[model samples]
Target: MPTILTFGDSNTHGTQPMRSRSSDLPRHARRWPVILGEELGWDVVEEGLPGRTFAFPDAEMGPHMDGRIGLFIALESHGPIDALTLMLGTNDLKAQFGASPGEIAQAAGFHLDVALSDEMQDRHGGFEPFLILPPKPFAAGCLAEIYEGAAEKAQAVQDAIRAQADARDVAVFDANSVVSVSDIDGVHLDTSSHETLGRAVAEFIVAEIVEA
Candidate 1:
């Protein structure tokens, strides 16, 4: 079966909104990654870390937040992947991080470069890369203070990511186009949103992978 390796933050990790950080939604069936796998009848390896960022580290959240390092490790362990899907950058908008969207995109580009390098391709026997623009953040209630300017940052990052995808000639999917942030926490997806994202992304992967 074709195998896909998915990398990103909490959304990719299938965190349940309004729940504690230690909690997670049932990833085997509910998360978009598994849903996509079911739709395509393919294998998916989920590698999502809450608070993950391509540019910065959350000292409070631990070193695992650095997605670049995590990607390196994942590529080493999950070599011979058929495809990769990435959805990151929201955590970079944290107030303490102080990263501009352009910088975030640049950091993400670094990870993409590493993932698509000739060395990685040789290890994976070749694979396609897909960039998924995370949903725009909703800065209200619990997220208002820490996630200030999150909507704007998401927009900026989305534009930058699209440009990068075009330049690299990789597939790009706008998560915002198919799903919206949950009103409960303002950052995570609701069950319905997850369903929507899964269906849309499954269709995208089908066209890109099977049809191509």
Candidate 2:
């Protein structure tokens, strides 16, 4: 089976926005990655870390929160992938980080370079990469307080990603087009949204990668 590796944040980790962090994690069946695998009959490897940032490291969230470092590790662990998907940048909008959408996009481009490095290409035997612009954040409630103007920032990030994808000739998918953030947290995905996103991503992969 062709293997696809996904690197992302809490949403990709199948976080249940309505559930407390102390509660049991969402079941594998609820995660989009698993759903995508079942839909495509492809091997899906999910590497999602909560609070992950493309370039910045969150001391409060621990060393592993740095997506740059995490991506390297994940690449080594899940090498020889047939395709890869990246979804990140939301955490970079944290009040403390103060990163603009452009900055986040630059970081994302850097990560894309790393994933497309000679070593990675050799491992994967050369495969196309997908850059997914995560769904826009809600403008109300707790997430609003945490990521002020998140919706606008997400839009800017999406534009940057589109430009980058066009320049690099990489496949791009807009998560916002297929899914919406949960109203409960205004950040994470609900189970239904996960299903929607999984089906959408599966379709994109079939057209962009499998058929191509």
Candidate 3:
């Protein structure tokens, strides 16, 4: 069976304001890997930390620290990761460098490459990795301030992620493109939104991992 690892924040964790069935947000499963595993028949592992990002911020539970922390955990863990999906930037935008979304995404991808390289090896002990990009933040009311305009910010980040993916020769899925946000917070995925994300991700994994 293929083993996929997902690391991100609340979105990957399926966190909502209230408890609801996984079906509500089929994609954002407070335990999304579990739902995806059931749907795709793949062994999914989640290492999502709330309020974390791929880059560390300057505050406690800040983006900068949490970002690197997730990478370290993924690297140190024992498992041959067939695929890795990352959903970050929400907290990074909320905490620091709101307008530098492109730069933040570039830095995040760089660190992810480092962690994957350290963890995986080719026949000659080289790095092999798979990566996915989270969709742009849902900009509604308060979300706009948080994301500094999620549409533009998300586009910048997406461009950066694509560049890195092309350079690394890894598969890329644009989650931001697949799902639409419906919350005032702009960061959290609602039930319907989460389900949409899960379905899109599951389809990507099924096509990339199973069919391949």
All candidates' lDDT scores? 0.83, 0.82, 0.63
Most accurate candidate by TM-score: 1
* Residues 156-186 of candidate 1: C-alpha lDDT, one tens digit per residue: 7789878877788888989988898887677
As for TM-score, the candidate ahead, 1 or 2, is 1
lDDT per residue (tens digit) for residues 1-212 in model 3: 87767778767777653232232533443345666677777777787666776665646454444677667667558466566676666666653455475677677677657645643543214433556576556545544544565565667767776777777767777776766555655566677766666777788766875555
Tens-place lDDT per residue, model 2, 1-212, is 88889899988888777434355665446789988899989888998888898989886788788899998899888767888989987788777787877888888888888877898898779866898888877545545677676766777877886787677778888998888987776788888999999999999988985567
- What does candidate 2 score on TM? 0.92
State which candidate, 1 or 3, has the greater TM-score: 1
Tell me each candidate's TM-score.
Answer: 0.93, 0.92, 0.77
The best candidate in terms of lDDT: 1
| Model 2 CA deviation exceeding 4 Å by range | 19-28
RMSD of each: 1.9, 1.9, 4.8
Candidate 1: segments with Cα more than 4 A from true spot: 19-29
- Model 1 clash pairs are none
* Prediction 1 global C-alpha lDDT: 0.83
